[model samples]
Target chain A: MADPMKIRATASGDVCEIKVLMSHPMETGQRKESDGKIVPAHFIQTFTIAVNGKTVIDAGTGTSVSRNPVFGFKVKGPKAGDKVTVSWVDNLGDKRTDEATVA
Target chain B: MDATRRTLLRGMGSTGLLAAAIAAGVLKPTRVFAAEYNKVAFEAKDLAGGLKGIGAASPAESKDIVLSAPEIAENGAVVSVTVASKIPGTSALAVFVEKNPMPLSAHFQFLNGALPEARLNVKMSQTSLIKAVALANGKAYMAQKEVKVTMGGCGG
Candidate 1:
């Protein structure tokens, strides 16, 4: 269990800069707890980015990402003031969606 | 002068209690607080300046900002790291893993107007200390964390 993810970015050329820190354990289902039960793997598997409703980038993930994962990315041809929506779905049937205006 | 005398007595009472406690060892030991900022500790040649342009310099950094990676890499490999800073006028962030043959793993320059905080993940070549240096307000600061690799890359 984690708090809401935070995001911020800076544009660079055709890139619409983006940074995201989401709240989750991102457990790899590898380690056993004190009771000797293996923790179930739960992680962000898909991330999609769309600018003003036009898709720009998409990605996949794995257990390798950090706990309470943070992601940095860029979108091609996006400008400041443009609306960018970021959404992700983890294997646990949980989903998150957020929007931020470029600046 | 009665009120003044009472106040003085109370002050003295507290001071004496404090003194007694210290002499009896009830007070916790005082610690010298150290300021920590993300810094690098590997060889990056000119990567430190690039990181400076990105606003990640230690308030203690004295040279090239580094992101340490193993010399030969065990798994090919991916490594862990920590970065601290000691500079001033810093407003952005970047990370470099020096063993990958390309020093740079990620770069972060802040938002239009926002607080300065940068964190990231990188693939490393071998085992080395990951460093981060940040510059803020014309001053530099640095911090580092040691990452020991156990699998899949960075040369076992």
Candidate 2:
């Protein structure tokens, strides 16, 4: 299982800023190991963020993203204490979902 | 090792459930994986090809899309970038590094009430033009910025 995603949500005025730090290898399949074998591509393919059960962000990522990526974005209208969930699906069909509350 | 084992078991269980659902016609696999990763887009060698791979052609340069990045990066291995689109009804945003072996770095789709803004770190081979494309009302808008890298990131 992938590591649990760390999420932080803070509200400033009427907008809430959400930051996500995901633990992933994000291997590009181009690197060679000590024995010279190419690493297979394993990276997150899709990421979605929801606020109060309403879908807000859906993204497709590739191996070009660095390992353990940190994504930050702002959403309008989310107030303090609103539920925020973030999830991701990798190329290998692996999935992880974690949630936080707007503070 | 323990985490991997647990994840493997969980993955198997979900796959079995999905298979049963598909067999019973209760779920469409395609719909479940609606946003399939575009290999061609990620492997495109040039900006035009990259855009075409993502189904965008002749994107107009616009100011509504904001791309924020350091003018000079001390390390190319981890260059931070942020993109924000002010266009109403914006649906998607993508980033492409002009000089990288593969230009397209990341692509994001915005759903209901999700703002068109994202921050991510990408690898750059050297100095390059980073382009951000925004899809709004079925039109493609773009913004670009150049970043100088002191060290190459792509295995330099």
Candidate 3:
């Protein structure tokens, strides 16, 4: 099982700003181990953000993203107390989903 | 010695079969779901190929697309990047590190009620030009910034 993500959604006026921090190695296959073996590539491939059960952002990322990535975005309609959900799936089949309420 | 030999043989046998299947186009690189992940764009080796893979071969330069990145990065492992598209009907946004092994770093599709802006961190193998592209009304626009990295990040 992967670690849970940390999500924060704060409303300023009608726009709700969201920030997320995910935990993952984000290994690139090009790296070599100290013993000369190559490390397998493993990274988050897809993620989705939803506000009040409505999908707002459907995204894809490559291995170039930094390890334990931090991502931020904004949505226009959500007000305080609206539910915001986020989910991510990695290349190795690990997945995590977490949610926060707009404040 | 014999046990190690047996394990090695077993590994090779399975990998050989998997390689054959992939070569014959019987399997893909294994995507988790039907999310809007474009395999070709993420695997493209160069800027032109990456742009074409994302369905924007010749995007026009636009001022409405803003790319915010540092002019000089002390560390290549984590460089902050933010892209904002003010185009009225912007639907998608893509970020590209021009010199990375795979130039395309990320792509995001915005649905109704979402803003076309994102902030994230990306790795660069070296100093390179980072480009942000916005798609709107069947057309693509782009903005780029050059970031100087003092240390390389791709190699461990």
- Number of the predicted model whose lDDT against the real structure is largest: 3
Off by more than 4 A, model 1: A12-14, B1-156
True lDDT of residue A62, candidate 2: 67
Each model's DockQ? Answer: 0.03, 0.54, 0.42
Off by over 4 Å in 3: B1-34
- Clashing pairs for predicted structure model 2, backbone only: none
TM-scores for all candidates: the values are: 0.43, 0.84, 0.88
What candidate 3 keeps of the native contacts, as a fraction, is: 0.69
Q: Where is model 1 chain A poorest over a 10-residue stretch in terms of lDDT?
A: A56-65
Q: How do the residues B1-156 of candidate 2 rate in per-residue lDDT, one tens digit apiece?
A: 656644544555344454455446554344455455676787787888889988777899999999999999998878999999988888899999888877899998877666789999998878999999998988899999999999877661
Candidate 2 residue runs with Cα over 4 Å from true position: B1-29
Each model's chain A TM-score: 0.85, 0.98, 0.96
User: lDDT per residue, candidate 2, A1-103, as tens digits?
Assistant: 8999999999999778999999999887777788888887778877888999887887778677888989998888999999999988776667888999999
Better of 1 and 3 by lDDT: 3
i-RMS, each model, one decimal: 17.7, 3.2, 4.4
Q: Quantify how close model 2 is to the true structure by its C-alpha RMSD in Å.
A: 6.1
